[model samples]
Target: MSKTPAFNRRAFLGSAAALGATSVVMPSYAQQIDPYTGQPIVGATAGATPDAGAVQYDTHANQRHNISSFRAQDWRPYFDNLSNGAILCDLTSRAVHYWSEDETVYRLYPSSIPVSEDLTRTGRTEIIKKVEGPSWAPTPDMKKRNPEWPDFVGPGPDNPLGTHALWLSWQYYRIHGTHDTRKIGRKSSNGCIGLYNEHIKELFELSTVGTQVLLI
Candidate 1:
């Protein structure tokens, strides 16, 4: 297993208290740009605290960070709807959860492509395909932004898709691995879900082509 971050509940609660309590919107999906990473992040929301068991820390940064301030409305409600596996991309928390015989959750920071608001899609979809060591092709829109961007990048360390990819039913979206570890817990993808290489490898091993993927 790759190095996983440590989770210390006592320390987290202490820091959270010091941070002060603030009221926020309900069913909060508010978005904002992160000052540190310059990537968009889901704004904090006002809701009941998540069960301690369901909470985990995203230890990519030196400071403490909670994976989710609110619980998934219905934990694993789509279990019966999946055959191969199921994945939840919690856009509100910048995290991912994989469901199989057993459940595994991961916190990620992904880069969001600067696109029109209409293009930011939200819904449930199926994993159309799965690939290992996948190549990347810049979209036409991406190329328009950077005329010099490479048309294709073969599987390698520099490949933006990293080592594994779970293609979604949505034509342009995917859940893939990332070579840049720093982007693991921020909003940084162009619609696709981004995970650390290790996390993706784990998911790839457990997931199959027909897996259900929820973008909530």
Candidate 2:
């Protein structure tokens, strides 16, 4: 007999394609940037909106979110920093944008939590590996153990890897999904990049197991 196709999280979050959002009333500290030069975009007054048309962002409000902090004069270090690799997000805008060299950049799916202080590491290296739906397996090194930890949910809605998972070049480092939808576009994860369920599904499907994940 035939078995069921693995459960896909993207299928469950179908609403993501039709999703909408409202803009956060950001603090004044978050705006200001050089347009021509990609530098430490200075902070701007709370009421001003700059770079109205150049910055590419995806927002829930369905209204334009100006990237007032970046100056057009600034220059991105250039993707040449690492060839055949993708920038997880565009720090030039200091916002979450993911795209390849030839593509237009857009806001990354929002993130759930801020960077946990626990994720302290001095340095990171680059490598390539295969990615698959994370099979929530408990490792011997886990500080704490969950006896009831789910194993191999077999690629369904409940899978934390969600719509997609990018197996990093290094071992155990992945860019995958989060059950936490509210938190995106911020620093959060256990040394891995997390994307919204829908967005990840798109990435996962577009990518393959050996796709290179660069974290320089």
Candidate 3:
């Protein structure tokens, strides 16, 4: 009979340690980078959408990520006064910064911006209307682009506008919640700014019509 090989305990333990280290490191790395793009995953929210052309994952992944810029900001640079309150939508950062009239409240939230520069509108605008359980109707241009899209979508899980909407002075423009939370921190909208459903609910309560808005 062949002599039994000596048990290589030291080698076995060394291999086991290395395997454990690999297990621990891989998931942390995976969480940081998007599987599809190999780019760092950035932002506070993520989810799916049913609306046509709503998920532009490839487009967003290819675009330069500005994760560092998504941060808190001062309200003074963009507004004369808090008034009802003030909202700053930073298109480049994909963030929404809010300030209460008395300076007691400040909120910074990740947001979704227009899909392209042509669809984007900068400068100042104001909240003209607020709606809860808001309904959605595709803009004529939206219908023209996707004739298969529904004529209307009532408030629910499928509504692209999510639970609330703060309509802006610019027609067809809104600071709203999106059922597609993944859109937050990405350029995925026709022209509106989108926040997570929960984030928008808090903003809706904290804000009022005439809240100053600036997109830059």
Top-scoring candidate (TM-score): 3
lDDT of 3 at 21: 13
Provide the global lDDT of candidate 2 against the true structure: 0.38
lDDT of 2 by residue, 108-137 (tens): 443322133354222333324434555444
lDDT, candidate 1, equals 0.53
Evaluate all candidate structures by whole-model CA lDDT and list the values in order. Answer: 0.53, 0.38, 0.70
Residue-wise C-alpha lDDT for candidate 3, range 1-216, written one tens digit per residue = 899655342443244212311111112343355433455655521232323224333343434435567656888878888899999998887778889999999887767787777778899999999999988887788878756567887887668888989999988888888654446667887788888677799999999988999999
Stretches of candidate 2 off by over 4 Å are: 1-75, 89-96, 103-107, 112-115, 120-134, 143-148, 183-188, 205-216
List candidate 3 segments past 4 Å from native. 1-65
Task: Evaluate residue 25 in candidate 2 and report its C-alpha lDDT on the 0 to 100 scale.
Answer: 30
- From the highest TM-score down, the ranking of the candidates is 3, 1, 2
**Regions of candidate 1 where Cα sits further than 4 Å from its true position:** 1-74, 77-80, 101-119
